[model samples]
Target: MTATTAAPAWRPAAPVPCAAPLPAVDRLRVAPRADGWTVTARVAVDPRDPNLAGHFPGQPIYPGVFVVETLCQAMAQAVPGTPRLRAVTSIRFLAALLGGDEMELTLDVDPAAPAAGAASPTEPGWTVRGTGRRHDGTVTAQLRAVFDAGAGA
Candidate 1:
């Protein structure tokens, strides 16, 4: 019989403690749509964010992971019940998110899509797709994520 190998599980880098709390969504608005729901959020990057310090000494660029976290936060807030991020299906970063930059994040959630894990239709789960854009409308990133229902509860 031929041997089989399984790919290693994916894991994020170890957390780096920050001197201060990381940036947060300044404003968030949620509106229901016929298709699903729409979430608009704004985040103001702080120059003093500890992540900016060692990220680059001279040139501090916002970490891409932070952008993803921002979108996940928006999804959790917009959706009812406790939602937990199951996986990031895809994400593309087109432009560098710089420190002190103001970013506009938009998320669209589709509850009809298949849920991850063993959650049922009656559960509170969704598939989320979103984009992060600069004030001038430059697309910084596009992401798709799956959230499990009541996982955080």
Candidate 2:
């Protein structure tokens, strides 16, 4: 008996619409301090963002990864010269960031010991740590990352 290998009823599905890319940050403010630098950034969570679409589907919440990216981007803008991320040493999500929530990230950038073998005479490393708080002052997330002071002259 010969077996026929025929494809069964394959129909192309309709194209799904895509959400527009959200900006890295809505507002950014940086200030210098004796200990380090303080960076404050605002982000408006849009329910229509792709990251929220399937994050909880019926109940959308801002993804934690986006929070980290937000902080990293803020650090890049707040620091002198370019900063290259070496590692995310720690991250914690304390509360849920819901759609329509306006979150304020307050990050502190301070000097840190460079990775053991990664340090050089001319370059230094920095640690960025901060918390994301809702407009009402509810802490939602915290993160810490190490970065190399990039491309020193």
Candidate 3:
């Protein structure tokens, strides 16, 4: 079964963190990636993030779902779906994202994918692909996310 999360019309003070490591949540720092936004951002794994409880007690590694979610969060700004989550396709976690491990999120937005497609604009969906890498370039996770702003609508 697929789960859908809906938020009321009011915005909150602090941004809500992604609840589970995966399975969807409200996270991501920036809004969207600009045309030439080539900068890479660092994301830290938090043990206090509440996702650890059920993930595994003694070994609370960030689940593959959340690893996909992390990529989702990192690329959200570029998707035109502020405070919203679209969809993730071909999402997979190659390795485990562990708590306390500093994570580097790198996303390469397909230039072929537009800010506004022939179909939608404000909901400029993005054909986004992201990978979570450790300092050594070890790929922990790889994600293929297709985001449409209207997805929430």
lDDT (CA) per prediction = 0.69, 0.71, 0.53
Ten residues in a row with the worst lDDT in model 2? 10-19
- 1 against 3, candidate with superior TM-score: 1
- Candidate 1 clashing pairs, residues 3+ apart or interchain: none
Model 3 C-alpha lDDT per residue in residues 1-153, reported as the tens digit of each score: 111533223221234344533423232333223462331446566666677766778666766666555555554443443434455666666677777776666666643354534334344555666767766678877766665543345
State how far residue 151 of model 2 sits from its true place (Å): 3.8
Clashes of 2: 0
Off by over 4 Å in 3: 1-14, 17-39, 78-85, 111-124, 150-153
Worst 10 residues of 1 by lDDT: 10-19
Across 65-103, the per-residue lDDT of candidate 1 in tens digits comes to 888767766665566764667778789999987877888
The per-prediction tally of clashing pairs is: 0, 0, 7
Best by lDDT: 2
Ranking by lDDT: 2, 1, 3
Worst 10 residues of 3 by lDDT: 1-10
Candidate 2: stretches off by over 4 Å: 1-21, 114-123
Query: Where does model 1 exceed 4 Å of error?
Result: 1-21, 115-124, 151-153
